[model samples]
Target: MRFTEHEMTVAVDTVARRLHAATRPPWRRGDAVAAYDGLERMKKWRLKVTAGEVVLPVLTALPERPTVGAKPEFTEAELTAAAQTAGRDVMEHRKPGAWDAMPAKRRDRVLATAVELTRVAVDGMPVRQDPDALIVPDHL
Candidate 1:
């Protein structure tokens, strides 16, 4: 799938947050870090081996962006608490200025190049009804 910059950023950050949480001493027994790490690796591999139509399995890997104009799900108190938790997470674990260093266009371009390289690689493989389909892992 062709992900927008916002979508990819949200996904990456979300995963990073979960990773951070899981790595803490109290949460180390849980599976969140392993799952997110696997997903991140899978995305990189899929991006490396698909062309033209890059349908990533990450469609369900991360939460969707909250819709605008939707009824609020949390009371003001709950929202405030949640924000405080997230802010703490960000302040300590998130790499400072990582987002600024990677422009969305550059990331997309890199993905595009990977797809192009996959197309070249697939040319020599046995023809299939859908060349890209071969790249999608059966286990998603």
Candidate 2:
């Protein structure tokens, strides 16, 4: 979720300072506090799309099911983990709504670019290759 100018400023002012104080090894108390605070205020965030033509709801309600799918190939645990890592990426094609508008192409372009960027960013993260590791989430 994206924050407005006012919201961004307020978050930086209120939570950023608390985060600095909790800096410690193994556990960042301040960071945890800031995360908790952000969760408390998650509702205030809005969905950000540059096109702004399509009106999508800014806030999301709690999902009905913790895991969406437990059928076919993916299990409940896999679905839960996937959902936790990547929240609803549901996007509608604006072309269906647009009536021969020039901006339709632009909207599709923006959506495509956003998806590509997300893919690149996710791939760019460093993968842990601990040879001694036996479990997927041993630390957890």
Candidate 3:
């Protein structure tokens, strides 16, 4: 859906916060590193969007889903459907025709990113202890 720059920023920030919280005490080192990298990229995109360098700051590549040893709570199809519903809910709140105005590629990219992010968030292991104790190295 087409969004104002401010709206997009808010949406990005919302998703970023969700991801950061979910990945704070990452299930694995690699997951933490990937989450950090994705957050960094999102930060850069936010800047570019604010500067008008990019109309939509959708990620070109989807975030990698974490591998869980235990049985997943949701199936892949369920997650995909949930993500699409979430995306649609967000779009439905916007002005009519705005979503349709966005190009198909942009819409698909946005949905893909959303779905990947949701999957990553949901797949993260539950942390019982304080997440702040674990420090992910910046270099990673």
Model 3 — TM-score against the truth? 0.40
Those runs of model 3 whose alpha carbons end farther than 4 Å from true positions after fitting are: 1-72, 125-140
Please write out the lDDT profile of model 2 over residues 1-140, one tens digit for every residue.
33234433433333333323333255644465455445433322321222111112211111222222221122334433333223223332434434334375665554444333333222232332333455577677
- Which tens-of-lDDT digit does each residue in 7-44 have in candidate 1? 44444444344334444576456565465465666654
The candidate that achieves the highest lDDT relative to the unseen native structure:
3
Candidate-wise lDDT, in order: 0.39, 0.33, 0.48
Model 2 off-target regions past 4 Å? 1-89, 92-103, 128-140
Q: Rank by TM-score, descending?
A: 3, 2, 1
Query: Judged by lDDT relative to the true structure, which candidate is superior, 2 or 3?
Result: 3
Deviation in Å, model 2, residue 29 alpha carbon: 28
* lDDT for 86 (candidate 3): 55
- Which rank order by lDDT, best down to worst? 3, 1, 2
| Clashing residue pairs for model 1 | 1-54
Residue 122 accuracy (lDDT) in model 1: 24
C-alpha TM-scores of all predictions? 0.22, 0.22, 0.40
